[model samples]
Target chain A: MNETQAETQTEIALDVPWNVVVHNDPVNLMSYVTMVFRRVFGFSKEKAEQHMMEVHQKGRSVVWSGGRERAELYVQQLHGYLLLATMERAI
Target chain B: MNIERDAEGGFIFSDVEASLAAMFRAIPSAADPEGSKAALDRLFPDPAAGKEAGLSAEWADYVRPELREGFENASTTVEADLEPLNAGEDGWTIPRDHIDAWLNTLNQARLVLASRYEVDEADMNRTAPYPPESERTLAVSQIHVYGLLQECLLQNLE
Candidate 1:
């Protein structure tokens, strides 16, 4: 309610980091997966490919880790684009 | 076109074009073509009985005439040989290599369409003004198609 309290709350909220993970699935093509990463995360082609490779080889990869809210948003957007995406707290 | 959410909470597109981009990616290439073709055939068989059932001319125009005719011919052939291959149980079982070739063809089509329509990369990224229902349908189809593809590939592997 108070200004100081509200300010502190905002700062605290910004401190938490969230992890965004893209799970491996059977259907989506590897190239298409990379393209989705580039389109959603604005990653360079190389970086996107790298992440996509990680998913292909390892079954899943943490494409991103950041604030919980933003991570959720990324997961939602990726899901919207038909990627199997999820989020969790980064330990 | 408008989109609607079905009882299952999945998105349904008023026009197939909104979902075609993602659908086009499901076809397999030579290396992984069988699964891709199978998926494509499952979704778009020749004659497209689903298309004929109750589709509008506007929706029909979403399909390229040649592609439409190809589907029809393919479906008919598959139907004619259904007993031998059990093809009628499903649709045509597209070989993976053929699917891959189809993907290349689709990419070329996209390139040509982009140029013809003057669709810039930036413009493609810009949010198109779609009805909420349509947007939801696009979202659902995009996710469902990818999920289904992943499932089919896994099934083949098993």
Candidate 2:
């Protein structure tokens, strides 16, 4: 591939936005969910609690948005914490 | 169960029931990917949210194996940490790095409990008192206990 072609590919990859979402479930405790959000996203307690509350009240929350690779990693980490997480191309 | 961060840079857990320790140890064995399908679904759900059927299938195909492997590794690490505890007497000290495994394992156990009891968002109020004769009494009680343990771990980390 030409240098310009590679650069264009990289730029497109960087521009693609994927959202990492966590959905509310009956089983996960609020505190535990908040902690997972903080641990995975480095969200402060207040920010984490805010997202947690959103999940609780609204049934889901978009916890993070970024490149597809990072979104996949975050969703995987959330699964490891047993939180319902998914990544999708951001609309 | 009570958990406190130790001077040695890990966390120590006390007041744990023997059965609870056994339960922690059993997580790796009990979390059979094939056998515990319902519980696993709750733990590692499909990410697609039904928006695009093809995308959800593709995502599951890409992510399921990794998620399964992750659950196995986390459960084993947590079991190893809890293996030495004598339950009622000896406390278990979780090394700092393995704390995530502990937290994940506890969360998985709660998922199993929730699955068993058919627990839903309405059932998660920690403050609600369970009816003594309710069939859900035992499972509900256990869920609260695990929640307390998880809270202790989270609080100490903060």
Global lDDT of each model?
Answer: 0.48, 0.75
Tens-digit lDDT track for model 2 on B94-114? 898987777777777778767
Task: Provide TM-scores for the models.
Answer: 0.36, 0.77
lDDT of 2 by residue, A9-90 (tens): 9998668898898887877778888877888999999999999999989999999888876886787778777888877778
Which docking class does model 1 fall in?
A: incorrect
lDDT digits (tens) for residues A35-73 of candidate 1: 678878999989998999898779889988887657655
Q: lDDT at A13 for candidate 1?
A: 65
DockQ of each: 0.01, 0.63
> How high is the TM-score of chain A in model 2?
0.84
Name the TM-score of candidate 2.
0.77
Best by the TM-score measure: 2
